[model samples]
Target: MLTKMGKKGSSCIIFSIMLISSFFSISISSEQMIDDYRGFSDSNNSFANFTSAGSSTVAISGEPAHVGDEMIASILVSNVGSNNGVANLIIENLEDGISHSGSPVEISPGSSREVKAPITSQEQGSVSYRWWISSNGSHVNASLSGEFSVEVLPRQTISTYLESYDWSPSEGLVLDASLFLSSGASRPLLLDIFISKDDGPLNHLQEYTIEMDPGRRNLQIFLGNPSADSVFVELSPIEWSPNPTSLNYSTLTVNSPSADPSLLDIECTVSSLEPTSGESVRMKVNLTNNDNFQSPSGKLRIVLSSDQSILAESVIPPINPGVSVSYEMVIQSWPDSEIVQLEIIWSSEESSSSVFLSVQSSVRDDGFALPFDISSALLGALSGIVIVLTGRLVWRATSSRTPSTSESGIRKTRIEREEHSANVQTREIDCPFCEQRLSIPAEHDGNARCPSCSMQFNVAKMGETTSSIDEKPEAIENEIPMSFSTDDILECPGCDQTLRVPIEKRPVQSRCPVCKLEFLAEKG
Candidate 1:
């Protein structure tokens, strides 16, 4: 009996090794995997085999799928070994380039239950995975390979301008994107998505992932706070694929309507009275969302200026979807002087939406101011009136005149005396530079500064100062010098005596010969 038992045991050992080589490490199609078989046949030494049994994973969700969205994949592994030891299963490698981070464990003798792993990663692509099943120690083992791909789609596209919307964004804003399948296909595509907020006190939202089918889809995005900031934002949807496959993506952003706050359909106005030159006189601004997206609750910020200055601002908060909101504010019109953009910022508890509003500035009417300015017509009327008055005075003087020899002689003498007086006065005019009333000898010699204001005036060759800048002094003097004389007076600081210099031999002031004090020469 002992001999017989030994023979049977040896035979069994040989059979086990052969069976393990053929069945323990077998590969097959996805449909062939069974919950009871553990995807392979078990030998006497075989530890675990998987059997497909449990809730399957869902794929192909749309864009803007909420945060923490889950994608679960499940399979069961059982121990076919005779021992009643614990069977530990671990994901050693994944197929389609998928990386699994979680461990699913089970004990075995007969069979272990199904295990599900919740996959979370922003990485897009095919999820390829394989697992190692050890029944007792590391001695008996088995493995199964599986592959699944996920796809994310693009967001819907809007026109360049809001056709008939109520509120318009000050800046064009893009929204978060939706997921899609290829063909915009279904299931088969993997994606990891991340969302973030920018500028204006908002932090980016959390990260999320999902599986999609195939095809085209939209990703929603939005602008930052309309009143406070103007920033570019991103909502990234990344996808990956295994070898022997290619991926597709959309390069265009989901556009918003042109930002025009005046189109907000609200009653907003500006009346700053003495408005700054560069600032825009903002009026009523309105905004309306055509897609009627799910938006947060907050003041509908309408930027008065593309730079977003708060001028005569009014906030319209809690605007609902499919409804209109209004805002009014004045902005520096000089830089933002043109009707550039209007921003409709809607905020909420979870997320926000920014709509672009196209704008056109208010048309101004300056008809009332025309009369006060120098109009050509006014100058023409004045000229005509002056001609009429002068003609009337000349006619009366000529008609009343009577010829007389004695009167003519007296008039001639008086005229001659008047001419002499005028000449004497002109010659006696003092010089402004020397503080002596003088005639304007020639004209401005060269560029000089007024002693009072230190203002440099370029004296044209015509002897007149350019009146564009400096104002005239209080007292007037028609001072004219026949020639500029630089040799007025001089003294040597080194000595206590004065020296005389000619106009041509004018000595440059250096060390005074009398007192040793240094003096710089003046450009006379």
Candidate 2:
């Protein structure tokens, strides 16, 4: 019974000691847990703080985005806390007209990640953004925000012009450009100017970046010593960044300077406006230089084209300034119903000019005379002479039948009778050119010209006239063979005018009626 009581006391004492030790361990663990939570709550701001180097990395592309323009905002985030988990990033407070989107990030401990969001605007105003980061899946608030600008600037436009349409090598080209912007605020812009020759590769002429304000901006640029057949200029904006969709451009053409505009004048005329088949097409061109002091000389070339094919050409005599010269060229002859183009080009070593003439075709089935035929034309002219002779004979027969009514009438009748008698006795001759008969009036007895042909001849031959028919027949028979032959056709060297020299008057010095210049005529 004593042993049993001792064992029970020992077991009771061990149980009591174990229970006291367990109570103290529970109290210590509870205090440690409370202190850890207090520390986490107190340092929440410091736990989510970004590093100083990374804080300045809130960069935005397209600093000044216009309305309807898209902008991008980029940032770098680091897990400053010593915990690694998925982080929930929420962006808010963007303007009503601006919107953005991004994805949640999984950040490692003490590491960083880049976040990008696309922002687009639909209205004009200041734009702002606010971002919140939840670290380690905790909902404690950690935030960052930024703001930018958006505007509705006026529509940008550009235009250009030239000083003169015609230019010379000595006189360069002047180009003027205008830029317009109606916005009150100043804006920066870029421009590129290009120039080329003969539709070749374009070369840089000028580049500019300017601040455009309200109203218009004018710029002038001159191109000197341009040595090419053609020049073209273009101006446009360089949109390196996201910019306004309103783009503008200007284009200009500068042809090679051909001639001095003040000194050169050209005129062209077609010989036959209504041309026919199987005949040469003739064109006359006159070139004149009005400059009094400067004497210019160059070659004149003429090119005729039909159906896009060149037909014939002509070379003009060299001309000088203040001097006028004319040239005739037989370009081409084709059946009617074809369009003809005559291009006359006058060029020197440093100057040139081009002129074009177009003629409409008019050909008939039955051909007509070659423009100037005096033979058939004279028949219609003889009808008037015949009518005049018939009226004179009727007047004489009526006057002889009726008695004179007054003294003036009787005097006129006597004069008419005497004139009629003399006309009947006088002789008539045939014209060599038109072959029309002309009567020689007694009043004009010296070197007389046939009114029908305008050919000058002497009627007084040693006091003997055509009334001596017996002797005149012998003289006429001998002289008829020397009147017409192939030697009569002659061209004047000075003015290119055709002249007819009677075969009897061969080996003679004659004065050209067209040019009035003298030249010796010899039998061919």
Candidate 3:
């Protein structure tokens, strides 16, 4: 709809085209009298309030043609009565059998009802539709008609292929699912859905078990809640409902390193933030591990205490091995002196040597004070902040408060003494590896060599009981076994059981009682 000024511009151009071609005059008629069609109805007296002053007849620009012909029509109805009134929509639609799809307005007295309607030709060629309006005004306003030509053609056939599936609300949302539809084609198709925790059909496409529409193919399949890049949706002829292909690749990253919130290791940084009384404060503690062997499980225990009692304690779970994890521990100010300590421990696991444990003191005390105004009126406003900062640590009397040291489960330290000169001097010269050391001293002056270490040492004669300063008292005597008489003789290594062993040969290697097994025990 052009404005009045815009219409004037086009009117000037039309006027120039008309003037250049020939001579003509375009003028507005103000003095001429005009009277619309006036005809008396057969039952005009039946309506006592039948008073109308607007035109009833209308002409749509793109109507009066075969079926399926689209038309844009307008209503030009006018009021014919002197009294001001509106034209009802029920009268307009019912009189012409026209179903309106949009807003219909009221037609006032001495005015018009201009409507734009889309006429679609959905019938055979050369068909006509007669449309009109009923009114008590003049015959010309109530009865109006026009016609047009339409050449019909065959309808176009289109197939709606299930190109792919589209997922909305993205990821990390808690919605069930959405609506999917495939229109146009009459044939039926199937649709399938797949969800992968990682990526690329790691979790394959599983068919939907819920009841669905086969003809409408209107898919309302829902997944619980998507937590990935996107779910692969396929709709192909292989299935019935959603024969869709995965249009977009929705990658999934779950159970990855980024999934966990904290970790455990030898040196760890733990952090926390809390309000002591009001003001929030944060704390970070670095912990180390000292153990006999490596551990499989990475668990850390943190105990937080105050001047009089324990505040917070956390048992952290396993962390990646051989790595440092940072934990943020919030240090809440109780508005007093608080003690915080961290204990890091790891348990032994397969393939690892042994577990280790370590504890460290991070926060010894809280020394914060909140400033306040000097007025009592502002006390309430700063009460929370003051207590967290000042009242928490408000000292009653300055006492030499000792630093706290927690009792641990560590083993006692063993004392290590220096080597003494006595054991070094008394160290045995005889070698025990080759059984060269004797219980009874023997005259090992010659033909005596230590089979072990290939060392030789002198000895006294006649198998003595005592020795010199470097010799043992009875090294050979104790080593030699006792002998027996003829009747009590044991078999000897040189003779049979017939040989008699005498008491004088008491220091000797042992001989078998039945056969001579001349071993170390029989020699004297």
Q: What is the C-alpha RMSD of each candidate to the true structure, in Å?
A: 26.2, 19.6, 36.3
Model 1 agreement with the true structure over 1-524: per-residue lDDT tens digits = 44677988878888889888767467443335664466344543454334333322212233332222344545565555554444333342244445453354654666666554555434344334454343444344223333455442332221111112122344334444444343422333333222232333534333334444344455544443232222223223344222222333222222223322322333334454344345555555555644333233344444433334222333444443457655555554523223545554443334445555554444344467554655577557666855675687677555434333132464456787677445542222222444334333243244443455433333344534344423433332212112222443343434433433333544343333334344443325
What shift in Å separates residue 416 of candidate 2 from its native position after superposition? 19
Winner on TM-score (1 vs 3): 1
Overall lDDT per candidate, in order of appearance: 0.41, 0.55, 0.37
lDDT of 2 at 257: 39
**How big is the positional error of residue 222 in model 1, measured in Å on the Cα after superposition?**
9.6
How high is each candidate's TM-score? Answer: 0.24, 0.37, 0.23
Among all windows of 10 consecutive residues in model 2, the one with the lowest summed lDDT is 473-482
lDDT assessment of candidate 1: 0.41
Per-residue lDDT over 54-173 for candidate 3, one digit per residue giving the tens place of the 0 to 100 score: 344334553333233355545555555444333322212332355533234445445655644455555445434444333343233324434333443332221222223433323322
| Clash count, candidate 1 | 136
**lDDT accuracy of residue 39 in candidate 1:** 38
Ranking by lDDT: 2, 1, 3
